[model samples]
Structures are given as structure tokens and as C-alpha cells.
Target: MRYPAVAGMFYPSNPHELIEMIEHCYMHRLGPKDMPSLGCYEKPIGLICPHAGYVYSGPIKAHSYYALSKRSDPMEETTVVILGPNHTGLGSGVSVMDDVWKTPLGEVEADKEFVNLLWRECEIIDLDETAHLNEHSIEVQLPFLQHLEMLNIIKFKIVPICMMFQDYETAVEVGYFIAKIAEELNRRVVIIASTDLSHYEPQEIANKKDMIVIRDILNMDEKQLYEDVVNYNISMCGYGPAIAMMRAMKELGYGEARLLAYATSGDVSGDYSAVVGYSSIIVE
Candidate 1:
């Protein structure tokens, strides 16, 4: 019964206004024309998206979802597992939510069955609904999923994972395990890593620093990605989830990744100083 935080500061508070905002982004930004159609390939195993406010990050986020829009399967037929960074610092490794997440669009029911199964298979994951409360990283993604239309017909569950102080080995092992379970269940899943790239740096500096991490990601170099973030003191908030996604994608047979789009808050607000960077990436 915990409705938690609604879209006010992050997105439009009014229901109709919020819907319009999402639609406008999708309509204007059609995503990369050079990329392969979503229907042409196997369902994406994972996606890396930013979680900044709609005004700043919405267009880039739309591009990420556009990549999935061409999938032949109905949204109802797909269960998206959105893995987001825990800004609240509550959960240790991974936190699973059993309750439905409410947004301006409507109530998004959690995939409790899948959550339970993950809990049984992985000792590092636990059910903690509190972790989801007031956490915008995961919540910001639900409206996009709802707007897809087909999602209304499919029963989808969400698993919000907040990784804390976990080593690279642990993340990789967890990713491998999730892939194995998804294969066994014969369920089509999309892993979304909700994170912004760099924070509070000059626009040029932020973009430069984020590109280094992005390059490593596109190369599928998990070690190099981690090292670059640490070595440069990069403020990319979702490095843990990105590492986890890279690990999981490799296990799922996706060896290559492409940078679909990259933009900064400065792009939207026309300010170059102290901006957050956002990028949309897909692994296939």
C-alpha cells in the first residue's frame, strides 16, 4: 500500500502533463537510424539507461526505449527486470520488491513469483520493499514501460537491485546466475540499469570522463570499466549496475554493445557548467 514518491520534481506532477511529456520525447527523438531493428534480433538481454530528471534525461531515455519498441513480442509478453543503483544506501547486494509500484499512470504490479525464485536461487538477494520507497532511480522507468501499451497485457514483475560494496567477482557471478535462471524459466527479460553518467562537472569535462567509461562498456571490458571509474574518481552513479549488466550480458551471449545516444543536462538547459551526463546503450 506504499505509494511512495510520485512524479513531481523528477517528472510532471499532473497525469496528463506527464503522459504528454513522455510522448513528446518519443515522437521527437526517433533513436538511431543506423541501429538494427528491435524485431530483427533476439530480445535484448539488458539495457543501460540514465535516471536524471525527465527534462534533462528524458530524450536519451526515450532512445533507449525506442530500441525495444520494435520487438515483435507484446509488452505484456515481456518481463522487464530494471536493475537500478540504490541511492538510499539501504540494501547491501540486491533488493527485491514484492509490492506493486504506483505511479501517475497507474499501479505497476511486481513480478512476485520471479522475485521469489531469485531469492531462492541467490543468497545475496533479499526481499526488501522499503528499499524501493523514495527511490527515483527505478521509479522513473515505470512510466516509460507503461507508455509502451503492450505492457498492459503482459504480467510483468520488477526487481530493484541496489548493489553496495560488492566486488566485481560477486557482480559477475550474480549476472551469470540470473542468465541461467532466465534461460531455465524460458522467460524473455530486459535488464535496465538506471544510472546517470557523470555528476556536477563542467559539461565538457563530464562528457569526456563519461566517454572513457562508455568506451570500455562498448568494448565489453568489465575490468577496464571498473578501473577507469575508480582511477579517475569518476562520479558515474551507476558503475556497479553497469558492471553487473556487462557481466550478465556476457553470460547471455551478447558480446557486443553499441552506444545509441549520449547527451548532457547542458544540452537541454543550455548551461555548460556543472552538468550531469546521460547515455543510452544497448547490448546485443
Candidate 2:
């Protein structure tokens, strides 16, 4: 089993404290301002959420999960495919770990069978856990899903993919095979693209750069998004995951995308001098 890597740092280590933090995020001024209900999920697709401390990105991250709570296709057997950027260059260029991921809330099993199937099909995919050991990008997303699980709003398995190499060619290829295999296996899925935008820039500069990246995401233009991030020199941490999710969504025949919320650490810290940008987006 993979244990909580950033338990006390990114979020609370105690279960109760973590639960309280999650509830507060849903009620934060920047968040949905209320808790979510057990509504039907009619069209399950993909989501883009920032991975940062609860104080900074939690409220914005809440927007994506809140939207998920609102709609999907009657949640049956489902798998959430998480794509995150590798902060520590520890393992494979592209890897997936087939182990149960534990958080303060509890354990969420990995779709080990699906993970293995995915490995067989894509030569680029690695079943390595080292890349995820100290990676906060993917770890921080669990509690949100766990919160929804505790609410009984949804039940799920996960396929966590970490990309050490975020080049356009590699990202697109990994995404294509993911969708292809899921379809072949007849697996129902919801994709999570985990990323944070424009690190430690002035609020104005961060906003400007992040908006350019978010626009391409909302437009579902993976190729254009990848190019813009490079050409514009946007320091988005997970552009590769964002592009991968977009490609997977397109392959599944889903089109429309929406920006749920966008904010930066400056909004909460009240320090506009420098901040990291965060955004919540959903594609269906």
C-alpha cells in the first residue's frame, strides 16, 4: 500500500481534522459556499484541479469536486484516472503504481487489474511506485475524492499516472492509450488532471500567464495548449497532465469544457507581491 506522503503538510494528518478542513473548503468564500448533495452524475468526464495546500488551492479545488457531486452517469462501476506531473525525478519518465493509496480519510484501492492491462498496451507506461513516493501533486487529490466517498456521493477506483517527462509527444501518446484501453475493457471513468499554475510570480503576472493556459484547456485544444505553454513560457506545473486529459476527453467524444473557478494564493494570503495560481475546470 502507498501511504500518505504529504499527510500533515499539504493537509491534516488526523482524520477528524482533515474532514473539518475539507468541509471548510466547501464553505470557503471562494468555494461553492455550501456543502454538496447526493445528486446524479450524468456525464462523467475529466477535471482540472490545482494541487497545493488547503489554504491556497483547496477552495478552488473544491469547485471541481462540487461540480462532480452535481452530475455524472449514475455512478456504477467507475475508475478515476489521475494524471499528475512528477516533481521529483525519481522513477520512470511515465509511470503508474498499482497499490492502494492511503490518506487521512482511508484507503482507496488502485485498479491494479486495469493498471496491469494499461502497462501491457503502452510501452511508454511504467508500473513504478518510486515516482509517486514523495510526489504531492497526486497525493493531495485523494482526500477530496475520499470526502465524496464518505458522503456516499460516489464510489471509485483510481489509476494514478505520474509524468516525469511532460513533453507533448509523450503526453499525447500516454493519453491515447489510456482511453483506448479503458474503452476496450469497457471501463467507466472520470479523469483527473492535477496541476498548479505559475509559481511564485506577482499576482498580475501569475494571472496573465495562467489565464492563457486555462483558455487552451477550456477550448479542449491540447496541441495549442502545449504550444502556448512553451511559446508563452508559462510555468504551469502540470501542462502535460492537462494536455493528456484533454486528449483522453476528445478520444471519448466529449467536447464542452467549463471553467468553474480560478484564484491564486494572493487572494487568500492577501499578499499580492508573489503567488501561485490555481484553477478548477471540468470537461464533459
Candidate 3:
């Protein structure tokens, strides 16, 4: 079984506290002030969320989750395939966990059948726990999903894939593999790519650099997004997952993307000297 590593740190360890934190995030809705009314769209197929602490990035992440919650009803079958960066540099290049994730709320069972399908489809993807054991990127997303489940907005399973090698080709391969599998299974799956933007830079610089990444995301240019981040030296942690999500959306005939929110830690701490950037996006 996989255990919570960042509990009580990144977020609350107590169930009640965690729920309250997430609720507060949703209610607060901190980020870009001039956001246009998020109109209805086709069923959400993917999301790009941040993985920072709730106090820093939770509000941005909430925008994506709240938008998705609005779309999910009790009648639909949803499976969330969460792809997170492997921050600890452990395990295989692409690690897939086949075990229950123990959170303070309860146990979230891994989708073994989907894991097996991905393992069979990709040589780079492996069934391993080392990457997940000490990683927070994937772990942080679970509680938000659990909160959604608790609200009865959506009941869904999860397939958590952690990536240590975030490269252009790897992202594409992973994305197309997921697209093929979902089609084969005739399932409705949402790919949630967890990432944080430029780290420890001035707020203005962070926003400028993150916009480069966000522009490609909005344009649905996966290769350009991947290349621009690397070439420009933008320190986006989950560009690989973002590219993969974009590719998967493209494969599924999704051509539109919506920018939900963007902000920096300085917005919270009131220290604009050096801060991490956060953003939330949806690709449909």
C-alpha cells in the first residue's frame, strides 16, 4: 500500500481539516481576477493542475476541480488518470502503482486493469512503487478528488502514473497510449497532469515564463510546449505530463483549451521577490 507522505505538511492530515482546507480554497477562488465566465463546454477530457501546498496553489487547483465537478453527475462513469512528475528521482522512468492509496479520508484503490493495460502497451511504463513512495505530486491530487467524491458530485476510480523522464517523445507515447486504451475500453477518462510553474523567481518573471508554457498549452501545441520549456529554461516541473495530456486530448479530437487560473505564491505570502508560479487549465 502507498501512504501519504505530505500529509499535515502540504495539506491537512486530519480528514476534517483537509476537507475544510479544500472547501476554503474553493470558496476563496484566488488567482487571475479578470477571468472570464467559465462557460460550459464539451465533457472535460483532461486537466492541468498545480502540485504545490494548499496554501500556495490549492486555489488554482480548485478552479480545475470545481469546473470538473460541475460536469460530473452520478450517472456517468469517470476514471481519473493522474500523471505527476517524479520529484524524488526514484524508480522506473514511468512508474505505475498497483495498490491502494491510503489517505486520511480512506483508501483509494488503484485501477489495476487500466494499469495492466498501460504496462502492456508501453515499454517505458513499468509497475513499480519506488517513484510513488516518496513523491508528493501524485499524492496531493488525491484529497481533492476524495473531496469531490465526498460531495457526491462524482464517483470515480484512479490510475496514478508518475514520470521521472519528462521528455517530448515520452509524453507523446504516453498520451497516445492512453488515448488508445480509453477507446479500446469504451471508457470516459480524464487525464489530470499535475505540475507547478517557474520556481523561485520574481513574480513578474514567473508570470512571464509561465505564460510561455501556458501559451503553447492554450494553442494545443504539445511539441512546442515541450520544446519551449526545455529550450527557454523554464522550470516547469510537469511539462511532460502536460504535454502528454495535450497529446491525448488531440488524439481524442479535442481542439480547445481553457485557462482557468494563474497566480504566484507571492500573491499569498506578499513576498514578490522570489516565488513559485501556479496555474490551472482544462483541455476538452
Q: Rank the candidates by lDDT, best first.
A: 2, 3, 1
List ranges where model 2 is wrong by over 4 Å. Answer: 72-75
- The per-model lDDT (C-alpha) reads 0.76, 0.90, 0.86
lDDT, candidate 3, 1-284, per-residue tens: 89999999999999999988888888774933222122233464789999999999988988888778766764665778999999998899998988999888888987788888998888889999998998999999999888877767677788899999888999899999888887788767889999999999998889999999999999999989988997889999999999989888888888689899998999988999999998999888
lDDT of 2 by residue, 41-131 (tens): 5655899999999988999999998988876433575789999999998999999999989887889999888899888889998989999
- Cα lDDT for residue 138, model 1? 86
Model 2 lDDT on a 0 to 1 scale: 0.90
Q: Which stretches of candidate 1 lie over 4 Å from their true place?
A: 2-6, 28-41, 150-155
Return the TM-score for each candidate structure.
0.91, 0.97, 0.95
| The candidate that achieves the highest lDDT relative to the unseen native structure | 2
TM-score of 1: 0.91
| lDDT winner, 1 or 3 | 3
In model 3, the worst 10-residue window by lDDT is: 32-41
Candidate 1 structure quality by residue, lDDT tens digits, 131-234: 77777888898888777643332335566666654467766766776677677677777888888999999987898899999999899898898889989989
